[model samples]
Target: MAIAKFAGGWAFNSKAMVADAWHSIADLASDILTLATVSVSLKPPSERFPLGFGKIESLGSLGVSSMLLIGGCYMGWESAITLYAHFDPESAHHILEHIGHGHSHSHSHSAADLGIPSLHAAWLAGGTILIKEWLYHATMKVARERKSSVLASNAVHHRVDSLTGIVTLAAILGANALESAAWLDPVGGLLISIMVINAGFGNTVASLYELVDQSIDKEVKSSIRKQAQKALANIRDGHEAEVRDVSGVKSGQNYLVDLELAVPGSWTIDGVKDLEDTVRTQLAAKVRGVRRVRVRFLSRDAPDDKKYAEFIPGSPGALPEEEGSSKQNDELVDGHSDKHKH
Candidate 1:
């Protein structure tokens, strides 16, 4: 699509079509970003990095969105230059004179002379429009199925490309039909440029927000809290305690929940384990994209300044109890050696 549009655009000397071509090229970059991010983010957690590689997807999106913004700005600038040339004969003559063309007169051509678009370019524009729209719908469907924000954003980018193609096609046919109104071609290009820039800016902002770990919806967090409280209450019968806190953060396409639980100090280790497990299970079942849940148990009788006992699945126990036991064993060995020496 990019090659066809670019070649046909130059052949027809249509600024709008060329802008649409550049938009197609930007879409190609977005596709590459989507592929790269999906591949990297699928890796499991490793020894060095325990959270997995989920943030790579957000970073990739940031880079891709930046590219889109730059491309959009460049296209807008080019279209502006073209519009200036179309409106001011003196500017056109200056450009031609610099190019050392045979005829460098200011009044050599008028706006009416540049208005009409060729038949071949118009046909190419129509084909591009159809292709882009089809791609937009297909991509959107897959994005929805996977519940991927990056993919959904790319799908919207494709729709913008298709819209640009539509604008180009209309301007080409309209200008060609209205012989005396040759300025419509550049005007259409300007309009498409603005649309492209706006889309790019919006995408960039969203990607940045994700990269900075922006909070999710209040209602979604509230729902998670409610489900967690209900699940905990069911599991901890007869215990006079309540949930301390329930917080969730977005990690790429999924969520990580930090659930603070308060339970009776008399409960055994096994009982606390069961509580954590039950809360995690309930959250995973109810929440749409909860990837990991870290449950922290606080003793009901312990001081408020005391730390929570964190229970995260998959991490080996490096708890304070194990450290205290190691210290006690060392002291016992030292005392036995001292008694033998005495």
Candidate 2:
């Protein structure tokens, strides 16, 4: 589709069609990137990376973001130049010649390069709209069936493409039909470029946040805490298990959950282990997007336990040594030290 649109746009000298073609090219590149990134990102954790390879998805998204930003900026600049030339053909040639340093050959040869958009270009835009719309619905259907956020996001991307294609089709048809409205094609190109730029910028920020290990939303944390609380309720009542904290960062659609559980000091190590397993299993079963669960148990009565005393065993706050016993021990140590003195 990208190739066909690009060739048709260039042959018919339609700026809007060519800009939309570049958008299609970005989609093609993203599809190729998704193929590799998804495969790697889906791999189970290994000893080398206990958290798995989910960050690969962010890398792929970043790559696509960069491509869109670069391509869209270039298209916007070119379209702006074309739009300017449509208003003042002579003035544009002067500006291009000046930018080209008065060289005989210039990047653009006046407004004539854009030419009159042909009906063929309008046909190409209409076809692109149809194809992209079809792709959007089909991908969305599959995404729903698989419950895959990745596929759903891709479906949304296709929807944007189709909508942009609608604009491209309208602009091309308007330019083809109205002799005085030739600037509409370039205007369409500029609008499409803005959309691409906005998409790229938004995706770039999201990927950056993911890379920085931003925590999941509060709603998810609340859900996790609620689940943990429910799991503990099912355990023995005297254990007094309570959720202390629920926190973690997201990687793609899946996330790792860090669960802090507070239990009575009387609970045995084996009991804590069982609780951990129970919470892990229950969350994995009941939660829709939890990838891993790390459970930490802290004794609720630890502050009152001898093991958690504020003072060390020999500290001043602890039991004091007998004063005479300490002095006699010091004299005995002095005598022994004199005998071994060097």
Candidate 3:
């Protein structure tokens, strides 16, 4: 009720009122849909879908944007037709007179016919477009931060809405001012249609890309690398740690990245387990968007003779003099040292 009152108070012209109402309804619907979709996506079974609920949100955004684009174009086309017909000057005059009469009630066609190209409507549409663009930016930021493909796609749809709105508003202004070149209105409408079609195509392309399991952005990869490195640093013998592979699966559209961490040989089972735990814990703490971390520890063993040479000075893969002697003694000090006593 309060919202309606505010909208009514702001709507001075019929065209303005119509445009405002359209935007208000669209915003309300989109907000409700977005919330519902997000809630569903967060549910337990959301991951059951191949593309997850992200695509659903994306589709919803695309639908709303397409509607706005089409409606704007239609309005622009009609205005062009009226302008080309050199719409009855008396109608325009009558509209002005009616407005002058302070009849703040309903506007009749007689008044509408006389209605000059609605600059107020154009401004309102343009402002709405800007708002959509702002929403897109905000949503996209959250998506990127969360690594959510669905939100990103929805943001793209919002971008298209904003672009179409801009084009429509520009056409409206041109048609009103250049009444002589009234064809601009229809041209503007046609351009808006083209933009809508292009946006649809873009959405399809994005969905396909996600479906193909395209590699994530470089920044995301860098973040993963950094986290892996941090995890490696927490291990006692992590000097030879290397990342084998980092792949993510989208179950129901949610991301779950699996990381393979290769470490040096000579780490015992307990040591490996500890390293894995450290890696997982450190990654969870340091990585901003990583929901889970699965660590696969790999050990690379040198040949037995090669291992012995690591401690023998002047031997083919031996350590330096003092260190080599110390390592050899350390290896022999263990209870199992007799097994290699020969």
Candidate 4:
């Protein structure tokens, strides 16, 4: 409704209106499609589409982004062409005066009249570029929060829109203000196309990165390891135990981690089970981001104590009983041993 009001009240040329209307419709349709895709993706699946359709939602967003990019590029091209036609500035000034003064004037103005203050078609092209940029950021934010690839891709289109706006604005301003450099308009349009292409390429690279299941950052992995270590400490032999693998799966806003632990062979089956349970329970209770934990136990042989025999020898510290006896002591000291020999 607001758009409609703007469209009606603005002193824009017919071509500008058509271009704006097209851009607006495409953006609206993309938004609606994204929402619908998300809903369908979240729906329970049947036999035909067995896998939960969340990924399809992303694909839908990608498709919408592609369309938006194409439309934006086309609009940019059209604006460039309008500038090349060398539209009259007097008509644009007249419309501007009418809009600024808030007066309805009955002057016949063609779409060509919506040109830049000095250049041909600058106003229409520049305005479209600006609008596209605004939409891009808005959509990107939504996509990032939802973790939707499609939305991110669409957002790239908006970035391209912004770049194009810069080119168009510069070109129009240059042509109008400096007649010597009138060729800048078309050159700027070409540059805008290149920028859009570059953005599209970037989106493709990002999508491929996501598809490859890339490893997370070292800092994040280290943090998770620290949390796991902290959680495992509650177990009996957990302090000595070695943690091998920790795999996590996202469930809604939370995460579930499966841990593999290596413990000593001395630990009984029941003891190992208890340790496993302790680790899982402790992690679930103590870890801030951990929603669930599954622990797997593996037995490890304890190091042999015999290897350090020199450091811990086996020997008796007590003297011989016969030598220590009182009778033996008296016989030796008082000549009692001689009487026994005789």
Candidate 5:
């Protein structure tokens, strides 16, 4: 699509088609990255990567959006330069000479005299729109079925490409129909650039939030809380289990839930462990995309702060440090320190 549109744009001197070609090129790159990331992210967890390779999808989205932003800026710059050159007498005369026409403002040049090529470009753009619209629907179906955000983003990219094709088609048709409306071609290019830039920026920000472990939707958290409470209420033990906190963050297509449960002090350690497993199982069954659950048990008489404290043992203002947290924290802090030093 990019090659065809680019060749047509060059042949017909249609800036809108040129801009659309650039967008198509970016979409090609985005598609490649999307496929690569999705494939890599599907790998099973290993000893080294206990959480699996989920964040790669977010990283790929960030790369794709950045490419889009750069492409849009370049297209906008080219269009602006072309529009500015149109007003310069020397530049306009040079353009006329390049098109094999004399610089006469007579407006009497017929299609045979001016060799109008915009019509053919318009037809090519129309073909592109049909193809891209089909691609969008096909990609969108898989994205929904898999609940994949990266695939959804790619589908949106296809839709945007189709819209750009539509704009290019319109610009070519309008310019061909009106003698004095030649400026519309570049104007259309500029508008498409703006839309592309806006989409890129929005996608970039969303991906960044995901990469940084942004919290999941509030409504989802609420639903999980309600479902978990109901599940806990079904336990026949005399000891009551209360949900202390429920939080979750998205990991690619799934969610990682952290739940704190408060139980009666009289519950035995074995009983507490069983309760945690039951809660985990219940939540996993109730939630749509829960990939993993981390359940923390707190005695009813424990301090409120301790209920939500970091599981790290020996940490100030936190619960007793777990056996391996100090080692993990040391490695984590050292890694960050080295990165900053570099």
Candidate 6:
């Protein structure tokens, strides 16, 4: 679509078609980002990135949005200069007199060219409108199902491209039909630039939010919490441990959960291990995109060990035999031994 639009745009003297072609180029860049992120972002967690490589998809989407923003800005600037020239040819010619041939001609020609837009450019624009619109629908459907931010961003780009194609097609047909309405081409270009910029800026902001480890939606988090609470319901009744809190972090398309647990100081290591396994298994199985679950055990009575150790039994018989025999000499040598307590 881009190649055809570019050729037809220049050949038919349609500035709007050329701008739309560049929009198609931006779509290609977005596709590149999508392809690059697919494999890398799905990688399993590593020592350096214990939470996994999901953020790579967000970074790739950011790159796509940045390109669209810069490209749109540049295209808008160029279209603005052309519009200025088209409105007042004499003034624009004098204003760009000192500029180099390469720079001045590019803008002046698009603005001052008297040739009407051709049917070829109109056909190219119309064709791209259909293509981009279809791609937008298809990609957006997959994005929603997979909860993929990058795919969603790219899908938005495709929708913008389709909209720009519509504007380009109308402008081309209008310019061809009305001899004095040549300015419509640059106007269409300007409108498309704004649309592209809006899409880019919005997606860029969203990606940055993800990069900062933004929390997921309240409803989604609540759903996850409900499912987790149910998972713990069975064990909470039998054990001395209870769930203290459940928090989560959003990374790209996935979520990482932190499960804070309050366990009795007498809770054995085996019990804690069982709790960890149960929480992780249930959350990962029941919740969508639960990539990691970290459980923290807080002991209620463990802090009193120091106070208990301070007491020295009066009788050696009160202690375990081997322990009493070994520690008896130390206790006799000094009524208190810091080493023994420690």
How many clashes show up per model?
Answer: 1, 0, 4, 2, 5, 0
Could you tell me the lDDT of residue 242 within candidate 5?
A: 85
lDDT: the better of candidates 3 and 5 = 5
TM values, all candidates: 0.75, 0.82, 0.54, 0.47, 0.76, 0.75
lDDT of 3 by residue, 190-285 (tens): 565455445445544554565555655567667777877777776666767777666664333445567766666766677778767777777666
lDDT per residue (tens digit) for residues 272-300 in model 2: 88888888888987777798999777788
Best-to-worst ranking by lDDT:
2, 5, 6, 1, 3, 4
Q: What is the model-wide C-alpha lDDT for candidate 6?
A: 0.78
* TM-score sort, best first: 2, 5, 6, 1, 3, 4
Model 5 segments beyond 4 Å from truth? 89-117, 145-150, 233-239, 282-288, 306-308, 311-342
Candidate 3, pairs of clashing residues? 52-252, 52-253, 91-114, 92-114
Superior by lDDT: candidate 1 or candidate 2: 2
Model 6, which residues run further than 4 Å from truth? Answer: 94-115, 140-156, 177-179, 234-244, 262-266, 298-342
Number of the top-ranking candidate, with TM-score as the measure: 2
- Scored by Cα lDDT, where does model 5 land? 0.80
In model 3, the runs with Cα more than 4 Å from the true position are 1-32, 44-120, 126-163, 250-253, 302-342
Q: Which model is ahead, 3 or 6, in terms of lDDT?
A: 6
Overall local distance difference test of candidate 2 = 0.83
- C-alpha lDDT score of every prediction, in listed order: 0.76, 0.83, 0.56, 0.55, 0.80, 0.78
Cα RMSD, model 6? 10.4
Candidate 1 clashing pairs, residues 3+ apart or interchain: 115-182
lDDT (10s digit) by residue, model 4, range 111-136: 33434334334565666666777888
